[model samples]
Target chain A: MPLMFDHVYYTYDASSPLPSKAIEDIHFTLNEPFFCGIIGQTGSGKSTLVQQINALLRPTQGKVIVGEFVVDSSKKKMKEIKSLRKYAGLVFQFAEYQLFEETVLKDVSFGPKNFKENEEVAVEKAKKALKKVGIPEEYFSKSPFELSGGEKRRVAIAGLLAMEPQILILDEPTAGLDPKGAQEILALFYDLYQNGTSILLITHDMNVVLKYCTSVMVLHQGKLLGMYSPLDVFYQKELLSEAEIDAPDLICLVEQMEKKGFSLNRQNIRDIESFVAEIKKMKGEVK
Target chain B: MKALPIGRYTNYDTFLNRLDARFKLLAMILFMVVVFIHFGSRAMDFTFYGLLMVMVLVFMRIAHIRIRQLLRAIKPMWFMMIFLLIINVLVVQTGEAFYIGDFPIHYDALFNTLYTFVRLILMLAFSLILTATTKPMDLTYALEWYLHPLTFIKVPVHIIAMVISLALRFIPTLLEEADRFMKAQASRGVDFENGKLREKVRAIISLIIPLFVSAIQRSTDLADAMEVRGYDPNGKRTRYRIMHFAKRDVLSLFFLLAFFGGMLALSICGIDFYAFIL
Candidate 1:
């Protein structure tokens, strides 16, 4: 399913005395099966932009189109909002805090049940999601609160997965996790994307964007600077500095090498391993 | 939810905002009493209440509060105001009566309802002035000072004041957290706005449970933080902010006392100002 935002503008507390524009003139479209990263500093409207995808927040102006559902500012009510929610699942930051059911299976099934799946089907979907996240069957019946921090986060993600959303929007999914744990969670999402799920990841880490994202959208002070390929975004030092975004260390290293008269192919460097291989190939050519 | 006007402090460099909060709190209580005063005569009551309304409005102006804010403060009481009107019309049947169809509407009932509504508005406006002008920390210090006398009776005034301050401080934080949780659950397909009663209850449970868990966790974290900073609930703490009663506060107190005494005299003298108007 394709997701599109048309001239979307959102203001928090619009009727209040101190209205603030959280996102302004945000226009973007995501074709299916694309792993896109949204990068900005804190309070740059990344979360506000994603919330409109599933109609958690209606735009103050313009509209958001998600597949067949439309959330427009002119309309006060939409019947397809619930369906839209089921089609686009949002995993909040520290999502594990949202888990409250007595058992892990029940917690995971909550989303499917809310979407009107029958009890048996909901339980089955929940079990499948749990297994997909690698939770053992024996732990399915245990209290979700009994799980460790990482396991609870996985369970929370499983809760959303049970809804079978085509577009998964995660806001800082790896925040506050150990390095290995964060890598494991990102790998799981990458695997899902590999099997044809569209992923929208909101992150402050530029390295994560270069490593995992096909394209990246830059937001600066609630405005979309532009959307570009990951390599293009990383190569523009002026745009990165203007947006107050730090270039990933790999890109910085490659730039330093180029300044010292060493020719390096920026296109071939996406991750540390690939960048290392590129350097070795350069050495071989020089020899 | 939009930020409620009550308990929200707006920063402004107005005269009322600069006044001591202890005096402000006392003046607020005195104003409330003044609003509740009745002269037992329609003309006197109307005239006195009208004057009090003007005074309250002037106070709001001095505090740099706009009409929009005053309306916002009264918005939440609309349901209760309507309920009060309905109850008065139904239960109190006195004075001249007229029938609309079979139902009889009494003149006294309507008059009483109007008076009650005006009183309520005046009370709310007074409170709005107090809260909008004073900072939360200053309010707590004033409360602690007032409750200092209770320490002689073995009350934990310092602890009570601390609790109140913390509660005030966390109101916005908790509200923001609740909003985030609601959105998270909504993304999972919990339709909070439209659902049957059972479904609504279930939806609310989904929200409340998460909120409750997060609240507890937050409090635990806060407790740990306070402990790490060596916050001793029973220890003697020196005052960081010492409040002094200024000349303006003294003048305001005298004015309040004079107004209260004059109202008491009118109530006792039984002078029917309505008869004089006639």
Candidate 2:
């Protein structure tokens, strides 16, 4: 089902004397499966926005609609909150810490079992997910706590993947991972996105957005600035600075090259490989 | 998460806020002792206790603690207070009894319940005042000073103080971490709110294990950072902010001492000041 946020707002400690608005009037809709990147500075409400998708945090005002499930502030308790969570798997930041099961396989199977999948089916889904994330069969029986940091993170992601959620939301999943591990994790998500699962990634890295995201949402001070295509977002230098986000290095390099009297096509140049190919084509045309 | 009423130090410029932390801690203990002093059957004893309760409220006002904070401080104990009232009314059936649909509510039971309830509220309010006025580091220093005598017997007061300060320091951090862990597990479809008793227990285990793992991880990181910064718990440490009792503190202590002595004497002699007035 299409995911939609109809003028959603979230306030921390709404009943307290000192209430803080975390996100304000956030409106968005995803009609189809797509890789979307949510970029914001710290305390800019990116995490708060994604949390409403799975009903982990109900909006203080307005409603979040995920397929058939609805979480509205007016409702005291939403009967379909658990089902909504099953549809949208959220991989938290530092998810490795959440690994508490005795074995890696059992840890990954925890999510599916929670959603009421039988023992054999849960283990099967968990094993498939672990393999998809590239964890070895040998590590399945080992204690999750004994695994390396990267392995633990993969197993955590595998835990979510076992549930086979339609919409996969990750909050800075690559945070604290080494560069190679981060890229591998991002590529894994990209593969899932290609396989038809909608991906919503919250990240501070502009490069990841440029490389993987089809569309980008910029949040500033608890408000949605706008959602634009990756190229459109990078093209607006003023908006980037306004949101306190740096343009990806590739974009900056392309801008510098264009400034020096070189007429190069910037529309399709998303990564270093494409930029290099564009330069080569330009050199040939000049000759 | 609801704001915890205790240990929430509000920054305000007032006599109690500026009072030495040592004196504030000592005053809190003395106030609690006075609150627990047994009252006789005379109305004068109850009247004196009521006056002491009023004095605590006055101190709370002087410290700039708002009425909202006082209510919040007492909010968590409300269920216990009601339970206490019910138990007292049921068990202490003495004096004149008023029947309410076959349930005999004794006059003495009501009086005893009121006394205990008032005492609890006064104790909580005064402690809240002490905590709200005193800075945490200063409180730790005061605690170290209190435990100074233990150092003579080879107890490491400095280490104990350091441990208390560190625990206080990480309270917020741990709370934030716990919130994060709860959300994470909730996202995984661990239904914490609506579940059978067995399922709820399992959900809590899920939340708790993650919290415990992360807490241990944080403590290790903290220990490493402290070691890197040359924190030797057993080593002698120089004081930065030394506390000195001011004239106001000395005067307040004398007033408290005189009040305690008068109340003690009245209780011992069974004097009925209200009866004399009548």
Candidate 3:
């Protein structure tokens, strides 16, 4: 069964002097093998919403069902949540810092060990995870902090991938990486998604959202403002503006080109390669 | 071990920050006692007040903390102030009883209570200023030095100091972690707010379990890291961040002595510092 939330209301500290209502009566669902992008301006409650799926948060009102697991306002956290986390690996922002083991291999194996997997199987899982993240097995013996920026980030990611979770949630996985590194990391999401893992991707990058996401959910001021296919979502300039977001440069380029007497169609072509194709076709017609 | 105010320390280069935190600590505790315990006799209280006024001036000069700001800091304690006012005026009726809707107010007891509350407010204000001005680790070091003699009595003073600083250092991190965990739980359909006491506790426990797990995981990681880094907690340690009191610190100590003397005189003379008269 897919994860579902019904009329979830959440607020922080009824007694707090600085009042805040993080999420209010929000409803959403995530189906299997889904590569979903959750984009929001900061404080739009995107982080709060996605965290609820893995039992990291319980809705203040209403109910949530993740597969057979029934999470109501009542269910106290059990080993079930731990099991859920194992099934649904959450790669937190700055997850790299969670690396506490002396060696990268051991650090990667930490979660599986906590899950009570035997040492051998845990190590094997770690190795597989490292490989999946494109890290050489030899680097496993080294300290995680010793790795360069991109490599350290991948190692941190490898730690989550090591658990072999079915539903993988990554928050801004490619942020703060070099351009090539960002491309490679985003491509890694494609690899993970193709392998039948459900992915909930939280990012601010319009380019990342436009490219890999199967469905896009836009969050604004702690509300689920809109959900749509990539092209439909990008064209709504006002919705993007209200959410304080921008469409990718490629989308902007195509739209700008359309106004300049060019009959460039954006459908069946949402990438730079397609843009390139349309440009080359135009060049030929000009000749 | 929690840093008294984890994220609230003000940053400025002033005399208060320069003085030996040990001195401020020892002197403040003594000053606090003078304010609270010496309330009955108005004559000696006058001397302590004179001393506190002098120390306040020296502290303001050195710490770069303003007296006006410190007084304003007491604004948040209005609830406590009201509680004190009521307790002073009622319950402990030492003199004439005034009735308000069948509740009798003891005028003399009320007078003493307000006096006591003012004393506490001033005491709390002084300590708050000290904490708000000094670094937690610095304060820990001050406590450690003050309690160094306890080492001879087998107290493991260093361990206590380490625990305090580490606790202080971790508060901000733990708060952030708790915030993240709460968000994560919320997304999962765990409601932390809007419930009866039992239900609220249940929700909080859901949040706390993860926080506890994370804390333990962090501690485990820290243990391993410390072992790898060759840290022997039981072993005598070298100081990377050394503590040295400057000449200004010595001058501040002298100022502290003057305050200490004045508080002694106030307690002997029987005066209420808050009222500026007996």
Candidate 4:
């Protein structure tokens, strides 16, 4: 069963005379291992909605049902929540700030340690997670703070992966990194999702959303603007405009081509890989 | 990440923001001491309280900010207030030093215990006023300029002032980062508050690790950038905005002195008449 929210709403300070609402009436559900992307402008409450999913934020006036837990209602103890944590791993924007270990190994071991895993076994899991993130074994003993920006990002992810969460949420994971760095991280996530890890990618990078996310959600000024299959969501130009965002360039290009009498679905335009693949498919069909 | 500040003091200026840094600092200190020392002796707390309200009202009017905006700034401190209250009442063990199932009831401990509780609330309020009325940059500069005389003995007042101001300025940013870290951990099912005290403390340590790391990194980068820009920590630098106290500032200083002097005199008289001193 997927995680669902029923009429969720949240504000920064509820008691304030004029509360600054972060999100409202956010309703959505996600089955396991879905590669979903959240797209919105600067203050569109995109982060707020995703935050509620993992119980990072309690809904001000609604229910957040993640698997068996009903947050803001359930009498479940902290131990019960720890098990839930094992299922959902969230990677924050600039997650590098979360790194406070003497060594990369020690840092990644934090999540497993929290679950009361044995020391040796936690190290084993940490090693595997680190390798998966492309960090060499030699870097295991090195302090994580000494690593480069991209390395720090991977290490942060490794820290989360050590928990072995089935559902992973990453917020703007590739922001402030180079294009190559962005692609590498996205590819890692894509592979992970394909291998059965649920992924939530919150980003302003439309290309990342369109290219990798199987589902797309749009938020605007603390409201659930819309959530749709990526293809369907990509064509709503007016909606995107109102949200102070733009559709993927490829999405627009394909739509413009369709408008000029070329019959096309105007989807699969997020990544250059898909860009080439769609053109090839079209040429073959024409022949 | 920039922290959201909520209060009547906006970054932009008015007459209050333009006073001599030293005068403002001295005035604020003297005012706070007088407020704490004499607040209990007043026959009409409401009138004095109303006077404070009017001052805030005047401050808000001049600074072009609304008093209504300070509501959010007052939220998070509630837990602390209640915590201190409970500790005050339960820890003193007076009033027959009795307990109802290991809970102590105290009589004489009431005032001594609750004194700090209310004192902090007012202290924070005034500090908030200080912060709300002044931008982080201006506050730091003011302190540096005000404390410049201390450097004659080789104290490096400018450097000390800079460090403090930098730390103060980044408080909100660090808080925001810490909050995000907690949220991220929470999503993964980490219940920070639901565990044993040791466990909760460990969770907090885990949360602070990244914030401090980022802080060190930012400062290192800042140091490098400053060095590259030909910035000299020890060298005298020209300031773009000249610091000066105008006629309004002189009047404000007089008001501060009069308020403090009257409060001191009132407290002395109160002690002579009642054999008590606040």
Candidate 5:
């Protein structure tokens, strides 16, 4: 399903004495299943922009179009909203803290049951999602809190996945995890994206964006600076610095290599391993 | 929604804001007692209470607190104030009857209702002034100092102070957590606001269950963090913030004492002369 944000704007505590502008004039469109990364510093409205996908937050000004669903400032039907939420599953930061069911299976099935699904179908979906996320069956009957930090996070993501959303929006899914745990979660997301699920990752970690994102959208102070391919975004040092965001590690390595007069092809360097292979290829071509 | 106005201390250099917390607490208690006594006495004119309202507004202005914030602070009590007025007007039926449509209104009840409304409003305004001008840590320390006498009766004054301060610290954190829980559940198709009574209750339960779990986890983590930081419930510790009562605090105390002292003299010396003016 396609996701589109048209001139979207949001204000926190709108009627309060001090209304804060969270996002302003945010315009973007994702018509295909592309791995998109939203990069920004803290309080840059990255989370606010993605929450509009599932109608968790209605835009104060313009509309957010998620395939057939439309979320605007106007009133929305509960059924329409429920369906939209089912279509676009949003995994919030520290989502493991939200787990409350007795067992992992029950917690993972919560989303499906909320959508009015039958018990058998919900359980089947839950089992499939749990298996897809690589959670063992032995741990299914255990309390969600009994699991380790990474396992608990995976269970939380599986809960959203059980609803079978077409577009998966994650806000810092790997936050507060160990390095290995972070990579494990990001690998799962990359696998999911490879299977044609449109993924929108809200992250500040530039390395994550370089390794996983096909396109990058940069936000600074609630304004969209630019949305372009990752390579194009990598070249815009002034824009990146203005947003107070760092370029990806691989991009920095490639820049350093070019500065040293090693003419490595930057466009082909997406990850560390690929960048290394490109350097070796350049060495071979030089020979 | 506007956030709850607790812990909203303005950082302006004002006499009220800079007054020692202990003096502020003592003055507030004494002033409230005098106001309540005046309310019960029925000797002073209603205009005296009006003057008190003006005085509070003046205090707020001197403290650099906006009139908008004062109104917002009292906005939550409008319904309760109106309810008190209605109950007072409907129940007290001893004075001369006045017609309002078909219902007869007692003159004594009307006067009593006005008096009670003003008293309640004054109480709220005084509290707003206290909370707006005082910092949370200062209030906690002032509370500990006020309750220090309870230590003789084994009331664990230090522990009580610690708990109060921790509770104040967690209010904003818990609010943020609850908001996150609500949005997370909302993303899972839980419609909290627009549903049937039963559905809404179910949605609320969904929110509360997660919030409860998270709150417990937060408390446990806080306990661990505090332990790691060498926090002890029974340990002798020095305060980080030392407060000294300065000349401004003395001036505020004098102002409060004079105002309440004059109110007391008026209440006692009225001799029914002010009732004819009302």
Candidate 6:
């Protein structure tokens, strides 16, 4: 099922006398098995936009449809809100804080148990998710707090993955991790995407976008500048500047090299290795 | 993720908003005491109370604050106020009793409860006005000024003032963090809304543990930031925004004193009180 946002507008504390718009006129759609990156400056409403996918926040003026579940102001008490969150699991920044169960296994099982799964079934799903996220079985019965920061993050992701969401939404999932840790986590997300789950990552890291994301949505002052394939987004320098989004270093370096008389024809090259290979080929041609 | 209405400040150059913070704080305290202690059941006392309420309403109007804001401030307290009224109405059984269904409603109990309730509401209204109109920094300075005498005993008054100001500053941050924690837990299927009493308590525990952990982490970061910025509680520091006593502040203080004095004299003479009609 394709996720769609229809002119979604949201105001924080709208009932108060002073209502400030968090997101406005946001429109986008994503089909299954796509890895999408949402990039924006701070306070540009990236977090607010991704949150609507799970009905954690309802739109003030429009609608957000995740699969068959629709989130609008009128759906405040809709029976599908719980299911919507389950289907589109949102892992917040510092999600490790959400773990309160005595054991990591129980913590990961919380989501499935909440969805009415029996104890044995939920435990089985939790175990599979834990293993999938690369957590060792010995740590299953240990306290989440006792684990290192990276381990805690994996456990947190396992908790959401156990829910078996069709679309996984994460806000700055690699915010506080080291480079290796971040790479490992992003690899996990890529694996999940290859397994048929669509992913929406809210991040400001352009490197992650160019590397893992298939398409990117650029937000500026609560408005969508454009949503395009990752390479296409980088080529739109004017639009990227308007959104204050920086293109990946490799893309900028390639553009600079092209300006310096290097005739490179490779398109949509995302990684450093591919761009270097293209540059080496141009050097060989010159020789 | 901003939750909790602890009354944010509004910038308005109105008579109340422009009053000297120290004078306003003192006048509010005295006014509350007079309203509570001298509220006799005479005709004149009721008239004075009515006039006091009218003055407050006029002040709010001049300050550009709507009645809805006042009502919103009182919204959370409605449950407690109603509980108080019902419990008092049912528990006290002296004086003339009337049957509203099987419960005995006593005249004296009802009168006393109503009197206290009005006092409580008025007290809350004045506090709301104070918080809504005055900036928190001004309040912190006013508190520092009022507590300056404690320095005679070598109580580290500056440090105390710094702590109070920092606490006030973190109120909004902690509230926002708590809101985020609640939402994060909710996403994990922790049912915060509907559950049995035991289950609800367990859910609350889930929320509090995360909130407490985040609070500690935030405080550590804040302290480091303060240290980096050369903030020393015992160090001598100069004020950036000096307090000034303007003409409007003097006028406000004069009016509050005169109003309370007039009420006192009228209550002594006993003119038209006895809870006046409505």
Task: Name the candidate that leads on lDDT.
Answer: 1
Cα error, residue B215 of model 5, in Å, equals 2.9
Ranking by TM-score: 1, 6, 2, 5, 4, 3
Report the lDDT tens digits of candidate 3 across residue range B179-266.
Answer: 7755544323335655568756755764675577578869889879988999877799888777887787788678768866765665
lDDT of 4 by residue, B39-66 (tens): 4333433345456556656765776555
Give a tens-digit lDDT track for model 4, residues A151-206: 99889888898888878888888888878877887888898899988888899888
DockQ of each: 0.78, 0.73, 0.08, 0.43, 0.60, 0.63
How accurate locally, in lDDT, is each candidate? 0.89, 0.87, 0.74, 0.74, 0.83, 0.83
lDDT of 6 by residue, A238-282 (tens): 898898878888888878878997777647477887777777787
Q: What tens-digit string does per-residue lDDT give for candidate 5 at A110-221? A: 8998899999999999999999888999999999989998899999999999999889999999898889878887898899898988889998788888788999899999
DockQ of the two-chain complex in candidate 5: 0.60
Runs in model 2 lying further than 4 Å from the true structure: A15-17, A283-287, B1-7, B42-45, B64-68, B78-115
Question: Which ranges in model 1 have alpha carbons more than 4 Å from their true place?
Answer: A259-262, A279-287, B3-7, B82-116
The per-candidate TM-score of the B chain, in the order shown, comes to 0.92, 0.89, 0.77, 0.73, 0.87, 0.87
Residue B83 lDDT (model 1): 92
Native-referenced Cα lDDT, model 1: 0.89
lDDT of 2 at B150: 98
Model 5's chain B yields a TM-score of 0.87
Candidate 3, after superposition: displacement of residue A147 in Å?
0.8
Candidate 3 vs candidate 6: the DockQ winner is 6
Q: Candidate 6: which pairs clash?
A: B42-B273, B42-B274, B43-B272, B43-B273, B43-B274, B44-B272, B44-B273
lDDT for B32 in candidate 2 is: 82
